[model samples]
Target: MKIIPAQEFEMKRESDYGTPEQNAAVKEIIQAVRREGDAALLRYTEQHDKIKLIAGSLRVQESELQAAYDQVEPSFVNAIRAAAERIRSYHQRQKRNSWMDLQPDGSILGQIIRPLQRVGVYVPGGKAAYPSSVLMNVIPAQVAGVPEIVMVTPPATGGTEGINPYILVAAAEAGVTEMYRVGGAQAIAALAYGTDSIAPVDKICGPGNIYVALAKREVYGAVNIDSIAGPSEIVVLADDTAEPSYVAADLLSQAEHDEMASAVLVTPSRQLAEAVAVEVERQLELLPRRDIARASIDSYGAAVVTASLDEAISIVNRLAPEHLEIMTQDPMEIMGSIENAGAIFLGPYSSEPVGDYFAGPNHIIPTNGTARFSSPVDLDDFIKKSSMIYYSKEALLRDGETIMELARREGFEGHARAIAIRLEQEQASQTGGNDHEL
Candidate 1:
């Protein structure tokens, strides 16, 4: 690790969009699924995942879901159930209702909030199985009252029953009614376009590799997507009062996610900066994924020294990190000044992984400075809102001219006429004659 001034520290973030070759491959895969349906889905699954499957056995049967529980340890099942409950309890507060505001003019102007009819959650099972992802993505949709929540993941191996037992157990605990043994760009296409076995979904959520990201981008307009999530990111903003060991461990937590992940520390105290840099080296040796973490620390990690605490905040806002940890004398006092961060950890005890696994909040946050504009996945991601407008006869007649004036100013003659025709009919009925005669 190296210590540099705040002015010299820059985040090395790669584009979420994959290479040209990858993009072309994704486009070809999506089109094949659209044209051939189940045939293309199975062929691609066999080619990419090395899993031969018949169309009849594509969906995960209920007996298999029940058998998954026998494979997973009792302790693992207990923890997943507890986490699911917390996640469900937390998101329950975010649930919204359909409401209408009755007006004095006898008009109802409000919004109708309804959950999407069907949603697809893509869980990555390439390098590892993310049972936590099943909880994070499925629980919120359940709280939002989504009726049909479908989940898809690649088989852990070549066999039809090669899906990871832990992931299966997690999805079952999270209340997923439908699941499929498929993965990669083919799975994304199946969710978006629909196959003979898999029904099309209204929206897709969760994280995946470069191919999966590109596939989601290609099929975006056909179905709604959560985001083109980037690699993991973490920034620890601390002062002299913060613990160096705690800071280094939290930074490494994110760095271990992948070689492209970024972990940075911004502080005003030079002594703390130097201490953390040394602590990071000592801790990296102990991590199981030290090779990945070392590459991440060597390529993208930094310890930025600033002139003042206020200046450190300015640097953080510019970066707009995905996970920000504030370890200071008074963390709460500093939190109000933070303008941009996907998730904020207030003290040393509140580590980034706390939110990633056990904490109630969703771990699916925006990345690569997208926190400046977006937010973490929540109940709103699973629901769609429709605006309700019931214009009263009195209100429409009163505001019809104003509406027409604005519409015509924008060169919309048809829009103006729509309002004009309604107004003319109402006026003629009221006066018992046409407007010209009146």
Candidate 2:
């Protein structure tokens, strides 16, 4: 990893990660899938994933899910169940309630919170199976009281048909009612537009590759999306007191995700930078994904030697990494000053994987500097809020003129007329006056 001075590194933009070709390819896939739904999905699956998916065989059955549970080792099943329990308990606390408030004049105003009737969760299954993604996506929707939760994954290759056993087990534990064996932009399209086999969802949530991200973007108006996720990233704001080995390990953790992943370190100590560089090189030798990690670190990762701790914090805030770790002498003192980050891990012990797995915090966070405006996935993602308003005759009479005046000021004559008509009816009902429908 290169160690640059903070001043020199400040000129970089985060969105420089993906090329225009990648974005254009994703857009074409999304448009094709939207234009041709199920047929397009099967064609893409066969071409991209090399898995032939029959229309009827797309949805996984309950019996198949149980068989998967039976096939997996008992110990791994137990772990999925335990993780599901923790995730469910944490998300249950995030559930919101509908409420309304009545004014003295009998006008009611508030928001009615309601969970989406159905939602779709996409879990990447090719090359790597993310059973954890299954748990993270489904548990929140269940806790939010969603009636139906559907999950989609790529069909297994090499005659090993069906979703991964761990994913099935996790889905069962997380209260997912339906499962589908489909992947890529086609899966996103299937969720966005109802297919003969798969039902459309209110919102789709989970991490995916570039194609999935672009598919979500294209189908955004048709269905709601959590956020347009980018490549994984981690920024560690460490001081001299932080252990070089621990910092190196955490940086490599995110680096191993993909070649596009970024792992950065910002500190005020030159000696610590050298130590971390050495440690990263030492650790890289043993990592299974060393080539990918090395590429990520070499391409996007860096260690910046800032002049002061304040300067380090400023650099981190500007970067707005998806994951920010404060491994300093007084982590708490510097934590509050950080205004942007998807998830903030305080102290040395709170590693990134802790949030990824057992920590109960959602790992599907905003990426590519989107933490400046977006937030982590939570119960709010599965629910929608509708503004509620009720007005009695007296309340309407009291506020009608104000409403009409404001509407008229905005050049909205129809809005003003609506309020005027209501006010006239309210006044007529109040006294023995002229009674006429406007």
Candidate 3:
């Protein structure tokens, strides 16, 4: 990791991470799958994943899930169940209610909150299986009262075998209604446009490689999406009081995610910055995915030494990192001043991994500086709201003139006429006249 003055470091744009060629390839895959459906999915699976899919084996059955439970360790299953409980408990508080209020004028306006009928969760399953991702994606939708939740993952070894047992067990524990052994852009297409075997979903949520992200983007208008997520990132704003070792470990947690992942440290202490930099180098040698982490640090990682704590905080808010860690003397005091960040981890004990796995907060957060506008995936993502309006004759008369005048000002003559005719009819009726069609 390189240490530089905060003002000297240039902010990197998200486009610097991936090339146009990569995007174009993802687009081609998405378009092919959209046009060809399951056949295209099978071909991609065979070519990319080296797995052959038989017709009936695409969707996992109850029997297969039971067998997965049998295969996985009992402690792992319990851990998944415990994580699901925590996630469900936390999201239950975010549930919204449909409400309405009656007025003296008899006009009624309200919103109806309803869960999505069905949702498809895409879990990446090739090199690593993300059981925690399964819990994060499914539990919130379940808490939102979604009736059907379908999960899709790349088959373990092509389509000949099933998805990872831990993924299956997590899905079952999270209350998923169905599971499909498909992956990549093809799986996204299958979920967006229903195949003979797979059902279309109202929304799709999860993280994946660049191809998967692009596939979700292509299918966005056809179906709802949580967000166009980019590579993972973390920013730690610390002071001299922070432990250098803890800061180094926390930064490396996100760095190992991918070569595009960014891990940044901002501090007022030059000595602390130097200490953290050394710790990062020493710890980098011990990580299992050191090559990926090294590349990420070389390209995107940095230690920014700010002149003051306020300056460090300014840099943090400007970046608006997906994950923000405050490791100062009083993290809570600084937390109130932070305006941007998908998730805020306070104190050394509250590391990024706590939120990623066992913590009640959802790990599927905005990435690539999108925390400036986007938010973490929550129950609201799996629900919709419908506005309701009603008006009685009295209410129409009470506001008729104002409504007609506004409509006329807007050049909506038909709207003006509609209200005008109704008011005129009411007036005529009051006078015992037969001009009902006024």
The numbered model that scores best in lDDT is 1
Model 2 residue runs over 4 Å out of place are 11-36, 157-162, 426-438
Minimal lDDT window, size 10, model 1: 154-163
Model 2 clashing-pair count: 0
Better of 2 and 3 by TM-score: 3
Clash pairs for candidate 2: none
State in Å the error of residue 57, model 3: 2.1
Global CA lDDT of candidate 3, please?
0.87
Stretches off by above 4 angstroms in model 1 are 157-161, 434-438
How many angstroms is residue 349 displaced in model 1 relative to the true structure, after the best TM-score fit? 0.6
**Model 1 CA lDDT for position 61:** 89
Assess candidate 3 and give its TM-score to the true structure. 0.95
What lDDT tens digits, residue by residue, belong to model 3 across residues 355-410?
Answer: 99987989999877788898999998999999999998988988899998899899
* CA lDDT scores, all candidates in order: 0.91, 0.84, 0.87
- Count the clashes in each prediction: 0, 0, 2
